[model samples]
Target: MAQIAVFFLFLAVIQASVALKCKVCDDTDGSCSKLRDETCPAGASDREAACLIHIYKDATTKKEMTEKKCVNRFKNTGKYDCIENPNNQQIKCYTCVEDFCNEKNSATKLGLFGIVSLVLSILVSKIL
Candidate 1:
């Protein structure tokens, strides 16, 4: 029936929108800096659509810290609240939609990939 077709189409569109994925990782050494392919968890809400990366320094030790997670902007308006002293302790928050957009070193990876591709292309050309 026409109604059934329309309903199915609507459902498909909703599914696609809700199924949006984002890279997720929490690491101190930055090993998990790479973006993941599939990011949606079971029964995730709309707020989890955004990727959040929060970088700050330890108050006592002054060690660089990083927190990467999925956030719902509707609930969390501010990214950092522990900044009691701006000069001593400062926090930076980054929000993005694309996968691995939160990775601070993403550009480095892309540059390395480009270099490798160029080398391979040159080798192929020489061989031919």
Candidate 2:
């Protein structure tokens, strides 16, 4: 029983460590509806990868450019944030995890649910 639990934990770790899939696009306008999905590659110093939604607006013309791509994980936390650039002009970056998680109605629900579901199933099997 202990070994089974350990095996499940190991599998969960492996699943979490897999490459992240992000929506990739660079649009002149504000449309990002039809974009490509790409799996993030390994980063320098073995850092984790994440989905990046970078938006830059021209202060003078007010022209906006939206770019979605996979980037080397900026922070260790998997939470999404839309932070403004201090030095740049009207540039914001939103980062997230999970496949195609750069959309507007995206959720950070990743492999945690699967890991919990599998562990619960294992517990039920042992009980029965």
lDDT of each: 0.51, 0.67
For candidate 1, write residues 1-128 as lDDT tens digits: 44544454455445445543555664446445544545644332424455566667766677766666665543244332322355445566666544445656231222233344455555555555
User: What's the TM-score of every candidate structure?
Assistant: 0.44, 0.63
Q: Give candidate 2 regions above 4 Å deviation.
A: 1-3, 26-30, 60-64, 74-91, 105-107, 112-128
Off by over 4 Å in 1: 1-18, 26-38, 41-48, 75-88, 105-128
- Across 1-128, the per-residue lDDT of candidate 2 in tens digits comes to 66666666666666676778877874545656568768888776645677887777755566675778787764556544555545436566767777667755344646564568568657855865
In angstroms, give how far residue 31 of model 2 lies from its true place.
1.7
RMSD of 2: 4.3
Q: Residue 52 in candidate 2 has what lDDT?
A: 81
Deviation in angstroms for 79 in model 1?
8.1
